[model samples]
Target: MKIAILGDSLVAISTAHSLLDQETDAEVHLFTERPEIGLMNEGPGIFEKWPPCPNHWISDLKSQEPSEGSNSVRRSWFEKAIAIALSERGCIIHLRTRCTDVSSVHVEVKGAGRIGSGRIPFDIVSDMRSVSETSTEWSGGVCITGGEPKLEITGNRSDGTTELWWSGPRKDTGSWLQEMKWIGEDPRESLTSEIKVGIEIARTLVDTIIQKSPGHKIE
Candidate 1:
């Protein structure tokens, strides 16, 4: 089966990661407009006594040589690690690629770095992009305490400083929201739940895609 995972957030990263762990032979393609991940201001547990990123896809986040301010790991570095790992795992990673149009069977993209602009075909096309309507934009930290991604919430934090990705089915066919980052009244408290919720939703979204895939047999 040819599967396409779209988006540029942790959920998208986790989806591609989990899809591969299924051990199926489906050809997986991941596309994002970001020239690279972690370019945004992602917070961290990078300096915590226990550094995270040890589970699945996030585990691919490698610890590079300690830099001048080795206090906390940069989200840019952390995210890039996962992308590299996904590429090594046989996922056709397309950076600087943006999907102009999407349907149930294919995605029209203008891509670079690894893919030229073209319409890519797929047996199943999963839209992981955050298409929800929200005015909130957040810059938060991320950690890899260890577990798969999932989602069970549908709203944002109280402060409006952050917005959590709603993994629920999007009313529109062109988009589905599934990102993981935010801050609330107590940013720390909200952060913890955000990761948990993010993981759950990402897992649910991808699992649904895999089960519905034409060639994959779900037992």
Candidate 2:
């Protein structure tokens, strides 16, 4: 079976990995226009903490310290690590390419610049791109920030240090629960916990696609 996943977001990468882990014989392909994997180039980091699974990707991120200068550099390293891990898993990754169109049986893709275009046959296709339409007035700070889960720290000491306080959930940000599996009821929890939830959500989606489709050789 052949599967194609669009976008370079964490969810896309996770879905590819999950499919490969579950269905070793299936061919998983990732399509992205970016030169690298990750959404950092698009905006702020969506993954502020380690994801749930303690795989090589998570381990590589955990091995680094946060105080290592700019977060962009760290994020880049993390992204590269994930790409490497994905390649190791035998998932075909097509960088510098974008999926122009997708159907039940195939996907059309265009290469970077004048490189040309082609189509890839696939049994399943997963669109992992971020939704562009969002209303801040309807969701507050959460919607304004692309609905990325965050950990906000409050209360500060006089010495520039802050006291740890309980995290609070933003009331307007629960809309994602309707579409994705949330780790907990609150989004103000630790970033690591939220990331874990994201990973699980991606895994669940891939599992559903595999199970719901008959004669797919997903097992």
Candidate 3:
């Protein structure tokens, strides 16, 4: 099966891995405008999580040397590393490519100058772009601004350690409404937990799709 996954978020990456795992012969392509994986202007604290797999992508992330001084530089390094890992895993990644249109069987994309535009036929086209329309209410003082609202919550755990989490929508572009980030001691464990959540969400979505079409092969 030929599958084209849109976006470069963690969910999109996880879905691509899941689809490839199910069918090794399946051709999977990722379309994104950014050269690196994940959001280009994502915050430093926010990290990309990966679903459980035979080759743990996080291991590559953890093994990287702390050569970069700035957090943004480090994040870019990690994102590039992830892109490499995905490529190694049999995913054809099209960097600097944007999906102009997507239908049931084909995805129209435009690349950089000289690369031009092209259409790729696929058995299934999954839109993994994140959309945020859900409104969250917190107990603290909430302030509405012209741009995206920022909400940060900090609580003390039973062990006396402090836990911090924040969520807000992307004000720049894309369908992503809001994104959440949690501070954890271990990046690997935190990422693993997040990936598990992503996988469950993906499963639910697949289940719904399968329910509609009982004969579809998704697993």
Candidate 4:
């Protein structure tokens, strides 16, 4: 079974991390736009590059100005959240994760341009459940291992699409929710719930895999 996931750094990393944790015999690959920084591990070789290329660009970026500051940190978190959202969509097309008869998947990430590409052969592909975003009404902050994420919710006139926006030195300003809509209830609340649902669905899938795999530790 071969699966391909093409998306942002967060989604790529999370998928890779989760699958790696599973430790299944199946082969897994991670795809991301920022693969240079995403896959580049400079462990123990930071001194070799000296001032130019140091180890842990993600860590270093987090410690700097906008990423390190209070408000900006929240912005950073949301930005990453948006990236992961893309992966949520990509996983579904990979394979029929809902059933056991299906095996292997090919996931692909499509956006402004291709940042990275890879393949993950597996017994099943995870499905994307939901997506969430914080609005001015949520009134809170998020803490991340690297930095916090910023969120901005906007209402669109065309289709009344509510989008989360964020900008910073190292952050990208864009709608994290992607194609999702904000119609009936409060946009922020709706998005937040959606994200929770998505996470829950992923969790359920993991449980199902574990139950069937028995001895295999599926992350």
Q: By TM-score, how accurate is candidate 3?
A: 0.56
Ranking by TM-score: 1, 2, 3, 4
Give the per-residue lDDT of model 4 (tens digit) for 1-219.
333333333333344334433433334433333423222311010011112111221233333223211222222333343334334433232221112122235443332333323433455554322232333222222123233243453322112222233222223323232322222234334323433443444355456556666477655
Query: What's the CA RMSD of model 2 in angstroms?
Result: 9.8
- Specify the highest-lDDT model's number: 1
Residue 25, candidate 2: alpha-carbon lDDT: 84
What digit string (tens of lDDT, one per residue) describes model 2 on residues 1-219?
777888776556766766676677888888888876752331222233333344654434444323322222133345556767888878788878977888877889898634359877877777767653322211212121233345352222122222121223444444332211122233233234434544675577567666767776753
Displacement of the residue 58 alpha carbon in candidate 1, Å: 5.0
lDDT of 3 at 213: 61
**For candidate 1, what is the TM-score?**
0.59
Q: Which candidate order results from sorting by lDDT in descending order?
A: 1, 2, 3, 4
In order, the Cα lDDT scores of the candidates are 0.55, 0.53, 0.53, 0.32
CA deviation > 4 Å runs, candidate 1: 44-72, 131-219
**Candidate 4: Cα lDDT at 89:** 31
Model 4, TM vs. native? 0.32
Model 1, CA-based lDDT = 0.55
TM-score of each: 0.59, 0.57, 0.56, 0.32
User: All candidates: CA RMSD in angstroms?
Assistant: 11.9, 9.8, 10.3, 14.1
Candidate 1 lDDT by residue in tens digits, 26-127: 688888887776656443323322233334454443344334434343445556767677787898888889899999899999977655888888877878
